[model samples]
Target chain A: MEEVWVTGAGMTRIGRRSEPLPELMAEAALAALAMAGLERPEAIVVAAMNPEEFVGDGNFASNVASHMGFADVPTLRVETATSSGAAAFYTGFAEVASGLCSTVLVVGGEKMTHIATPRVSELIGRSIDPYERSYGATMPALAALITRALMARHGVGEREIAAVAVKNHAHAARNPLAHFPTPVSMDEVMASRMVSDPLRLLHCCPISDGAAAVVLSDTRGPVRVAGVGQGTDTLALRHRHDLTSFRATQTAARAAFTMAGFGPARVDFAELHDAFAPFELIALEDIGLVPPGKSGTITLDGETALDGRLPINPSGGLKARGHPLAATGLAQIVECVWQLVGRAEGRQLNARVALAHSIGGLATNNWVTLLEASR
Target chain B: MIPTTVAGIGEIVSYTTLHSAPEGFRSPLHIALVQLQGGARFVCHGAQTRRVRIGSLVAIEAVDNIYYFSSLNALDRARLFWGRAGRAGDRVNAMTRSVVRRLFKGGESGPN
Candidate 1:
């Protein structure tokens, strides 16, 4: 396998926006192109979760490339629900690793703010299993179910869950491009309206329109791709061996760390997918950043803060960073790159190795990626 | 993978009260994953009981081709007088009434 480097990282401000998908993607792509100082990419890989549902368009990869003014470059699109962005990273990595293309541009974005909340909820619910769909299981509802189980098993409570929101909000307060940057108190999070049982509005991430892009080249930059791995499980949570643990994420993290020849204990930082507040702690455990069922109180202890030991989600994560579905994975990668390059600005942390993890359908498909500072 | 169904008793491992039920579905819905007596597990739309706790015994009740977990004890005990049979009897009575109404309407064909 050939080595691949993250040469450039760019993204538009993550929040509700009115621009079209192609335009948003083009903005991020041009930023990456300029940062990389390249005239053109050898190839392009676009990632989108559901453009057809969002904008009634199907050929999104070509549309994005056309908007980027690329003249007849080989391009393709990858979609694995929420994990599309990470999958696109792997796709570009493969293109370069297999000696097919030297420099590949990977861009992922989504336009979801304009859609109504209920419609958005309904559409997002489509990614779950059909059997589960029959029971009308939305993502947050399923997450709430998992939370109830975890709370019972681990003696966790709403106070610990609310602490996650408070901590991420504090991190987002210092991030210029974060969607929500105000510090939230645990009281506020608990008092917020309930979106699902045990999960308040503050506990959930806001729908946003955003795009993020990265340039993967054969040349090494400040940060290089260390390892990547993926895993899958049954779509329905009922089929999983345990509801409190995500086997897909655990498996992916193991594979990625094994390939990188290091364990989570050695990782300096992580950008985990925390679409819901409790998920921050849950994913920390799932990726082996912490031992099983032990992250409940660790979150309350301020260990995952920006300057704390093994700071997680310094970019505010999905909770405060805004969740654009497809763009989230790439945005996480962009944050890792920025941190590795000493460019995270207000949220900078002294780090050499960073990890990013994402999930597709309710723990059905998951990906783990590792990035290390080139020494 | 091979498919199998568990109609016997099971235990509720985890559960949630769904507030935002999908369109066309009723809200405040009760859903749980039950580990069947034989070790197989599946999701069950459960009866809206006063309280749902982990490790509660439930019986598989079928209605309109849908399976649901009905609490074996109405008051949190493994008593022989399980409430599931009463619900099943109620469902049977409702079906009987519907069938009688259809018969009184001169055998008009309709979905059961």
Candidate 2:
């Protein structure tokens, strides 16, 4: 198999948009093509979850391909809930690495703002077991429970969680495409309305409508996909022995690091799945980037800031970048690619390698990808 | 209404904890895959119980917002007592002792 490099990347401004899903996806695809200096792609992979429910349309991949003028190219869809973006990128990478295609375009898009908030909550809750849903165990409820457990077990507090939101929002202030670009104070985060006990409204990623795209080629470039790993666990959280960590994420990260021939100590930066504020801390531990209970110290010390030693979520993460479900994972990859190639603009960090981590459905499925700069 | 029939129901599958559950929910909640008669499955929460055994055919009952299925129903009690006509009368005898204890504790003394 050959190595795969990200030659181009683009994302639509993540916010509530009146534009249709296909149009938003097309815009991102065109932007990526322009960035890559290519007019077409050999293969296309679209990542969208439940477009039927969210946009009243199916065959979303073909629709997007048609809109982007890739009508005759081989196209397919990939869906793994919030990790759909990463999953699609993995597929595209495989296509290029296996010599099936020289270049592949991976696009992840979602139209979540069209639905009502309650309906969105209901749809997201469906990812949980029906029995859990009956007991009112929504995603926020689970995250809240996990947050409380982490706090009690690891001595993490609301202040640490608030620090994550504050830093991400501040970083987003320089990102023109971010939905929530306004920096928030820790006090504002603490005072935000509670969605589920420990998790407040500001702690959760917004219901966003947007798209992100990346072009991958066999030609080596400034940034290359050094490693990719994905793993899954039981969807029902009750079956797991531990609640404080995601076993799937740990396993995926371990495999990714092994494949990349590097460990956390060698990594310069990371983009973690911060669907909820507390998740960043949990993910740091799971991914072996931080010690078991010391992630709180990192957050409290502002180590995750854009200018910190090991900056995290310089694209503002889901907390500020606006998580459009399937699009979030690909967006993380785009951010890492930008940073690795010195194209992150305002939020660029002095880093040569970065890791993008994404979790699907409460960490049941996890995908970790490593991006390294070519010497 | 979809008029979906209740198929073969299974016991509680699995569940998780909601430590930060609003006001009421706090304990490690139990969730199950209730298999309906028509092969359709629905996820549900199990009622508060000391123990939940697999393959235990529990009767489903609803009260207000919650649903429960347990072996402590009238039909189960009758099957344990009157239906077991011969060999193992010891199980009935033990149940009788429990009823006596309940009566002594000023609780309802009925078989169910």
Candidate 3:
């Protein structure tokens, strides 16, 4: 089996931008191509959540290829809702590891800031069950529903959930490209407008427009794709057997750890989805990064801080860093790559192993990627 | 999947109130996941009720393809009826559903 490595990573500022979808994606693609020092990749794996609805573009792979001067190269798009970028990484990694493609360019982008916030919420709601969407269950509404479940079931408190936003913002303050970099205080986080009960505005990630890219090859480098796994579950939250635990994340994390020949205890750092601050806690528990019902409370003790023992979401996470839909998953990998190679300037930490996890559609589909600094 | 039936009373697994309802729905719509007496859990509309606490005994009454819940023992209080709570509900946009179906899939899902 061929070992996969991340040779280069590129990301654009996450916010409302005037650039078209193709142009935004092209910028990231070129940056990654140059960084990887490759003229032509064996294949291209592009990802976007709702280009057709948001930007009125559908043939994303072909347009991105043409814009990047790789029109004739083989290309395809991956869509797994919000986790599209992570799924693309999974696909690109397999292409390289299978030896079918020695080099693969994985790019993901989303231009969401241009649309009205409510419209964007509707677009995001499209990812929910139609039955539930009819009830006006936006991402935050659904997240609030789950957050309520965690609070009721595991004794999670609102203060602990507020702590997630506070800590992530403190970390984002150092990330130059983060959209909401200002470190907000716990009082501010708690006082913010309540979008959904128990989930204030501060706990939610901004709707961002941006792109991120990563180049994968079958050559040894500082960042090796030790393992990647994907998991799927029932789309509707009600259909699932459990509300607090995302079976998808658990399944994906288990597969990733098994493939890497390690366990959660070995992970030095992590970049899990924090689109909703409370989700960070749930994801940590589901991925086995922490024991059940502990991710939330331990967070108050500086356990998951940038300088803490686990350092989950050192890149500001989706809460403060901004979630650009498909770009979020790939950006997570980019952050890991930077951290592994000692280039994460402001939030840099000494670590050889990093984990990136992404969730799509209320934890319906999930991906877990393990990156190592070396063999 | 085997077919099963759920009783009217159960406990609240989790709940949420949506203040920003879409075009077809009214704001401040309350929704919840309820565990039926028979062990089958599902989400339903919470109506005519203020402050539906978790782990409380809730009664359900079905109407118009939507089910509503009340934390009170409505069964005992005789408060259990298809009472009107106005437009605030998971009121399906018939037009939107068809259009969404055409735009995405025959019968598509929200979270991918």
Candidate 4:
């Protein structure tokens, strides 16, 4: 199999926009094509979690392809809840690596702001089991529960959780495309209204509209997808043995690192699924970058910041970059490629290898991709 | 929307406690996966519990006009299961009957 390299990546500013979903997706795709120096791609894969819910449109991949002027190209859609982008990207990579297509375009987008906040919650809540929905258990509720468990089990304080948000927002302030670019102090995060007990409003990622696109080619280049791993667990959290840790994330990250022939220590930077502030800590430990229960300590010690030894979430992460569900994973990958190529403006780090972590439906489906700059 | 009573109680499959909530929700909520007595499963959220052991018979209670099987209500155990059919009408009836028959025939002896 030929090596797959990300030749180009682009994304629109993640926030509420009057523009339609197809337009946003087209903008991102065109930007990626421009970056790749290609007029069109051989194939396209679109990832959209719920265009029906977000934009009242089905056949989203074809619709997006049409808008991008790739109507006749082989097109397909990939959906795995929030990790749909990463899943689609993986599919495109396989297509190119297996000689099916020399170049493939993978794009993800969502228009979540089209609906009311309550309806958005209801739609997102459907990701959980129906029985859980009947009990008013939504994604945020699950994250809150996990945060509580992590705090109690690992002795992670509220301040440490706030620090995660503060750091991500501070980094996002430098990102022009960030949804919430204003840097907030730890006190502000702590004082923010409580969404759930321990989890404040600032701890959770915002609901935004955005799209991201990446061009993958068989041609070797500065960055190659060294490894990719995908794993899934029961959607119902109750079936799992633990709440504080993401079993699927651990399995996926381990597989990815093994496939990449490297460990977490070799990664100069990482983009983890920080849908919730506490999740960063949980994911850090699950991904084997930090020892169990030590993520909170590392954050408190400023070890995951931009200037830290292992910079994490330099694109502000889902916390500040805005999590448009399916678009989030691809957005993370875009940031990784930028950092790897030293194109990330303010948050660039001295890193050759980067990792992108995405969680689908409260870690029910997890994907981890490792990218390295070719020597 | 529908009025349902606590009929039979089952074991606790798993549970988690939330110290914080997401954007719009406030207060800590505890979510649990409870296997009802008749093979029906449900995910419930409620007040925190210090001890949530498996096999504890919990009572279904109503809060905020929502009916949920809450933590163990020791005092209502006898009344909760009394006069309540094993299955929620018929669909679950066949499933539960077959499950019980298989359990006994399979050499698994226990109170139904």
- The better-scoring model by lDDT among 2 and 3 is 3
Q: What is the lDDT of residue A321 in candidate 3?
A: 84
> What lDDT score goes with residue A166 in model 1?
92
* DockQ of structure 1: 0.23
What would the per-residue lDDT of candidate 3 be over residues A1-375, giving only the tens digit for each residue?
799999988898887789998888888888887878888898999999989999998898998999988988999999999999999999999899889999999999999888888888888988899877776677888898888877765447888888999999999898988888899999999899888787889989999999999999998766899889888998887787677778999999999998999999889999989998888988889889899878877999889999899998888999888899999999999999999999899999999999999999889999999999984
Off by over 4 Å in 3: B1-7, B48-51, B73-112
**Candidate 1 residue runs with Cα over 4 Å from true position:** B1-8, B47-49, B74-112
Give the C-alpha miss distance for residue B110 in model 2, angstroms.
38
Q: List clashing residue pairs in candidate 3.
A: A126-B110, A127-B110, A127-B111, A128-B110, A128-B111, A135-B90
- Across B1-112, the per-residue lDDT of candidate 1 in tens digits comes to 1224436565676767777777887887777777764457667787684555665566765566566887755453323333367644544444355447557866532211
lDDT of 4 by residue, A158-242 (tens): 9889999999998899899999998999989999987755578899999999999999998876689999998889887666667
Q: Which of 2 and 4 is ahead in lDDT?
A: 4
Residue-by-residue lDDT tens digits, candidate 1, A1-375: 889998999998999888999999988888888888877999999999999999788899999998888859888999999889999999998898888899999999999988888899998889888887787778888888788777775446898889889988899898888899989998899999877776788999999899999999998777888889898999877777677778888899988998889888779999988888877787898888888767877888889898788798999998998888889999999999999999899989999999999989787889999999997
- DockQ, per model, reads 0.23, 0.08, 0.23, 0.14
